[model samples]
Target: MDREQHVHTIDTPKARIQAPAFACDSHIHIYDRRFAASPGNGAHIVDRATVEDYRRVQERTGTQRTVIVTPRPYGTDNCVTVDAIRQLGIDNARGVAVLRPDVSDTELDMLDRGGIRGIRFTLYTPHQAVVTFDMVEPLARRIAELGWHVQLHWTADQIVEHEALLTRLPCKMVFDHLARLPPPVGTSHPAYGVVRRLAASGRVWVKLSGAYLDSQVGLAGGYADLAETTRAWAALLPQRTVWGSDWPHVTETHKPDTAAIFDLLGTWVEDEAARKRILVDNPAELYGFAR
Candidate 1:
């Protein structure tokens, strides 16, 4: 089987959604086989999705800015993501890297200069993490000095459990995948309230990404079940919200059409200005894009 076939194809019907200028896809991963998977990383690494391949996605989604994240496959070796940032150009790209607690200040500085704006703690993946929840507060303290934030991918319950720690972190917080909260429980979940309150603190941001991950209604419905929750967050915290396609849709049994994902944003954020805030202004401030 061709490895390239495993990556998502951009063939959805023309999206009703159109992105505003400087629209940013705030979450994505680039998997290059040259970057060896970490030991004990049980996660299945996918085919190489290079900078150019993602540009095709940009063409389809009409998003010019992106945040290239280092997935668990690369462990703490962020060569592929750092390289992608450089190729995509510092002005249009930012990155979220994964690093060990013992990483040197010199190395951190180098990554900071390489367009990395935050460190990720991906608790939702099957693989063992190089940085766990317990390490977040301490690491946030160190990165806070450099004006870097902490990005997290955790289950909804864990968000509630770690609410205090999240609030106490010295730097800003970004929650991936709508906080990964399940439906029916959805915003009624206790963690959702905590997340809302944290966003109120003016230091927390949430990515409108990974709709299928938490959708009880599944992909056939285009994850429409999440629309209400998505609208609540957008209306309540437009300035703190951003959109991401979760491109490659690696976790799903089947890949979702990226164009459809862009279209979904229209249902969630109907007001043109509010949609621009999620796609443009919020990401610009959170990721330090030049005006």
Candidate 2:
């Protein structure tokens, strides 16, 4: 693992920290127009972020494993993410899909066989979310039988507001983008307490990615302002945390430097072992990747 290895990325330079062998980028999205959005898809932009493009992202970040999350624009159509996993090789990639409550048992089994490891709820924007919050509990119950977790992309207020409903979910939880914590440092937010309580109870996982999404500073001073959010979670639950690239960032007017983005974990947790736990071990266990 050469620390100075020359790896290419879409908008950023090569990651300064050399990722350990079996390192995994636990969150990303693959969008291909050929897959076609489902009827449930809301009014949203569709982009061509194919599986081939993510291969270069893997190279740039020095990661060999990935967890491809079905983006909201596709609604309940998880074919794009599933296709990406197949193309990337199931041994190296897994998926977190979005599903309607009426999804049949056969469909769930098929997704399980195809390497889908979890279900995602994108509730941050209620107006655009096809799979609404009420659908979460029932789907979470269904997915739990398959040993899959429920990943959420909820706003800070949403998390606090739904604490009761969330607490009752049968499956484990992984919150996306630092659990979408309120910006300018997330510790003060009430959602922080909710996540911390859930995390302490052993049913929660938080991803230390997508700082630019909430940061008002906007990658200022190398995302220094976002460090508090990252460190707060990393320090609180090292085992229940993972890192991601959130590749082909669709919502952003300016895409982030994923390599530089990956390097921030290096700064947050100087311990090589701790970083490996977040980048390798925890995701392998959570996503059921082979050890």
The reply for model 2, stretches above 4 Å from the true place, is 1-12, 39-48
Error of 1 at 241 (Å): 0.3
> How high is the lDDT of residue 258 in model 1?
79
Candidate 1 lDDT, tens digit per residue, 1-291? 332343354443445688888999999999877667777767656864678778877877889999999987788889889999999999999999998778899999999999999999988742466677778888898899989999999999989988889889888998888888788778899988998888767898888999899887787887988988888777777789889988777887777777778889988788899888899998999999976
Q: Give the whole-model CA lDDT for all candidates, comma-separated.
A: 0.84, 0.84
| C-alpha-based local distance difference test score of model 2 | 0.84
- Stretches > 4 Å off in candidate 1: 1-14, 125-127
Clash tally for model 2: 0
Each candidate's TM vs. the true structure?
0.93, 0.93
